[model samples]
Target: MNLNIFIITSYSFFDQDLEKLFLCNLKYQDFSKNFKNYENYSKLSSNYKLDKSKHWITNVTHLFKFSREFKNFIKRYTNYYLLNCLIFVSIEFLPEKIASVVLGFISFQTFVDKFGTVFSIILVTILQMSNYHYTVLILTTFYGSWNLSEDLLIPYFNKIHFTMSEQNQWLNTRKGVLFGIGLVYYIMMQKFPLISFIIYSNAFFNMGFLITKITNEIPDNSKSLGTWSITESVWDGHDKFLGESLTS
Candidate 1:
């Protein structure tokens, strides 16, 4: 997981930085072509420096910024986590007979998604109900692996400028790989709870090298697993709210 995270983050960071450099160079080229006055050129250079300083400040204080994007991400993912828990708890509270029926319904929904969400709740519920304590513990470690993958890949997604639908499509197509990466991350977290963040920072670079290799070698037309309707709806709603908030 750490390696995957590292790879994705490294690719995204370098990609974005290269893009910025390209754009800045182009702007300078245009400015030079126009043969602006020395004072105007000086002003333009100062403005660029000012913008860079502001960007640095923003990065330094990002954790305390509470920007709209951060708020939206937190709200959306929190809803997903709560919805998953609610589904699991509701299933557990059902009578054994009815629980089976509910499980069938969940199975149907997952099938409709072509097993895109990986039927995670169904597996967890079954394991718990069957009283497979050790198995449940192990499975639980990887239960929210998808979410972890999504969290770690945010930089990559942003760098590529993927729309909501595009993001979902990309994720669905790579579900198995992402899940495996996330499972490794979960294992590390369990093994090194206190120093997990430090470990993650180091592994991030390692993951970037792997990502570079994978992207270079693999074609993009791989088969997709399926999309998560609930997640899609939540993202849609979040976007709508943001749009309306901005308009008003």
Candidate 2:
């Protein structure tokens, strides 16, 4: 495999967008003992300016940032992490082709997407890390299918729902809209064999459905807060415990 291909595939498909974030947001203070090889890199000065004094500082920064982000992602999104882990473990037990198909479909989800590249890299790193192998093919296929579903199909479905609900009384319910959307995919798969891969996978559709299920589980008042955008200041109730604010 070419160096460029390995780097692109590993960084883009495998790491998701984490590698990009790590490279872009690296601060000068990142060269501490948290990173394996850079224990002494930043110890000399607390106020050192970033420059090319050391060529390998960026590489060390990548490792430190990756470690921190990976831990934080797993901690804050524990359920999402566990689901991806389960999917990864399933790859070992299932047939190679079947596992690849499932992995590709699951990669469409936001949380699983981040670890997809990492998982792909780990699979091939020991024996043929540089080779552009089946892992790459499977992940890229899944990622592409996911993109098509999200960018094209879901928006189309939403439009159809809105149009039909406005024109027809019978097609106004949520169930009616869902059924109509599923019917569209079913018809497409039946009529056009070429696009069957995307129609059958339905990765984005499943994600939307799962999220809707979770959203319905939340209590009424809490759901409103969940969707609201917060700007700068945070609210903390005082209840005269520490004296009321003068403005209040």
Q: Which candidate is the best by TM-score?
A: 1
For every candidate, C-alpha RMSD to the true structure in Å = 14.9, 21.6
Candidate 1 residue-wise lDDT, 1-248, digit = tens: 23343343334332344323333443454355442222222222110111234565564355225332233345545655565565566557867666555544544454445545557556545654664333324433444455556655543333333345656665665566567777777678658867765555544433443333222212222121122222332222335444654797
In model 2, the runs with Cα more than 4 Å from the true position are: 1-113, 116-121, 126-131, 152-192, 195-211, 216-248
Q: Tell me how far the alpha carbon of residue 156 in candidate 1 is from the true structure, in angstroms, after superposition.
A: 1.6
The whole-model lDDT of each prediction reads: 0.44, 0.34
Tell me the lDDT of candidate 1: 0.44
Candidate 1, poorest ten consecutive residues by summed lDDT: 41-50
Q: Tell how far residue 176 is off in model 2, in angstroms.
A: 27
Pairs of residues clashing in candidate 2: 14-117
Candidate 1 residue-wise lDDT at 229: 23
Best by lDDT: 1
